[model samples]
Target: MDTKGIEQMLSVLRSTATQASGNVQESGPANAGGVDFAQVLQNSIDKVNQTQKQADQMAEKLAAGDTSQNLHEVMIALQTASVSFQEMVQVRNKLVTAYQDVMNMQV
Candidate 1:
């Protein structure tokens, strides 16, 4: 339930949206901000995986009759994981489309 992870995911989604719309700047080095695109992508995927794993664990605990686990919290965690996963899928689709567009272009 770390807010920072959520923020990072949102930022990744936003960056993907910007790239899909061809709004990315080309005035300087791509990694001028000292951020490695591959690392960011890996981190995002890891975050999504972690979120899903956590949700699964929470659901299992609830089903196992753990009285300390609240039903509402588990439901919320499941929903969050679902939404994050969907967002990641959309980002992947956009990246694939962008790559295709680049590859099909005549040099």
Candidate 2:
């Protein structure tokens, strides 16, 4: 296991989380805040999309029975991509729940 690589990945994710949360700064009611939210979500979605794409390519190569490419490496990449996409879905769900809660507040 490359602990250093995992640490770097965690550090990058932490920074991204802070940035996406920070991007939601609201200016006024007219803004509706939707544009900022959409932008951040789209950015995240794009990232997951890229992972999915890479995973698909890797899977294709693996399915072709390419001996040169280590099967373990390909499987690990697929799992990593799957988990990342799942985490993104969870994040999206939490964000929507938070937004709903905010909208429900009386004052």
Candidate 3:
């Protein structure tokens, strides 16, 4: 459990939320800033994947008699990964529903 890494991740999410709400202004196009919506989404998914992998590894290590890793930390990591994944799924569902609604709209 890297506190610095967790803080950095949280900051990224906060900035992304602010940007999405139009509270933050970019000097150029999203791609130019290297922070477009697609990129942000991809980064988030990647982070979630990394977290899941880390959690899995930690669990394995703990199971293998690794005394450095604590059960509480491993459990927290697992729960965080699970919640992040669930949130990503919900976002995908919302996107799908929005797309369907748009398609069903009468011109």
Candidate 4:
């Protein structure tokens, strides 16, 4: 499974948190060396949604007895979509946890 997106998100979160804690100077762009977190998150979600849509189309075509749609290919697409979605959920959980932790921190 591809994890580059998740890694980038985590890296950005760490760097941002460090900067918040006054370890890094805020003289330039907040996320100077990385992509925007919101963009990365949206792209990841879009990718998952696209995969799910493709898998649904493949499954429907297979059900309709389309000769071009192979059963294995449809199954693989479904599995890929499922895995990507699960990964997204996990990332969301982590983000929520981090947010809660930040909220609980002392000023």
Candidate 5:
């Protein structure tokens, strides 16, 4: 229904992630930019969460017998959201583990 909303959300998350990772320069004299990893990660996570929310809504609609949409479309959206959430979780876990490992290293 709201495909454009999804596209915008995805783009925001991408730009945010790029900025957070210090890959994109925000400050440039003429036309260059850089990304800050923190901001990027935050934005990406927010977008992913929003996507998950949308998926949840779709699922709800389907469950309520509002069969206006195809089941495959709903399922695909749900799966995509699930995978994104899981991937983000794994990334967090890895970051935490690396941090712990570094903390335990010899000074």
Candidate 6:
């Protein structure tokens, strides 16, 4: 991947993190229209799913000898999808660990 693509991805991650934190802070007892944690998680998963789908389509097109598709772009997309999936898995593992720890805590 090029520096520009990496920078763009970092910017997107930063914005998403900021938005998630902002939503958490704003979702107090008085905020009736606050975002739900489940919804946020679902949205993130959906985005990752979409990225993976796009990558898959690009790979398929390339394999079918599509002249319009660039090899570098297809590779980048595949890598991005793979990294996103790994990150999501890590997040899920952390969440599960946290939940288990909370459950095991003595009240």
How many residue pairs clash per model?
0, 0, 0, 0, 17, 0
Query: Given candidate 4, what's the lDDT at residue 99?
Result: 91
lDDT of 1: 0.78
Give lDDT tens digits, candidate 1, residues 2-107.
4454455457656756766779856467646644457767887898999999999999999999998999999999999999899889878877876787678666
Predicted model with the maximum TM-score: 4
Q: Candidate 3 has what TM-score? A: 0.67
Misplaced by over 4 Å in model 6 are 1-33
CA-lDDT, candidates in order: 0.78, 0.65, 0.72, 0.88, 0.70, 0.72
Q: Positional deviation of 56 in candidate 2, in angstroms?
A: 1.6
Summed over model 1, clashes come to 0
lDDT of 6 by residue, 49-91 (tens): 9999999999999999999999999999999999988877876
Query: Cα deviation in Å at residue 69, candidate 6?
Result: 0.5
Q: Which regions of candidate 4 are displaced past 4 Å?
A: 29-33
Candidates sorted by TM-score, descending order?
4, 1, 6, 3, 5, 2
The runs of at least 3 residues in candidate 5 whose Cα sits more than 4 Å from the true structure, single-residue gaps closed, are 1-34
Residue pairs in steric clash, candidate 6? none
Q: Enumerate residue pairs that collide in model 1.
A: none
lDDT of 5 by residue, 1-107 (tens): 22443344346556645755569854556435444456756766887899899899998999999979679999999998988888778767866775576578665
Model 6 TM: 0.71
Question: Which candidate would rank higher by lDDT, 1 or 6?
Answer: 1
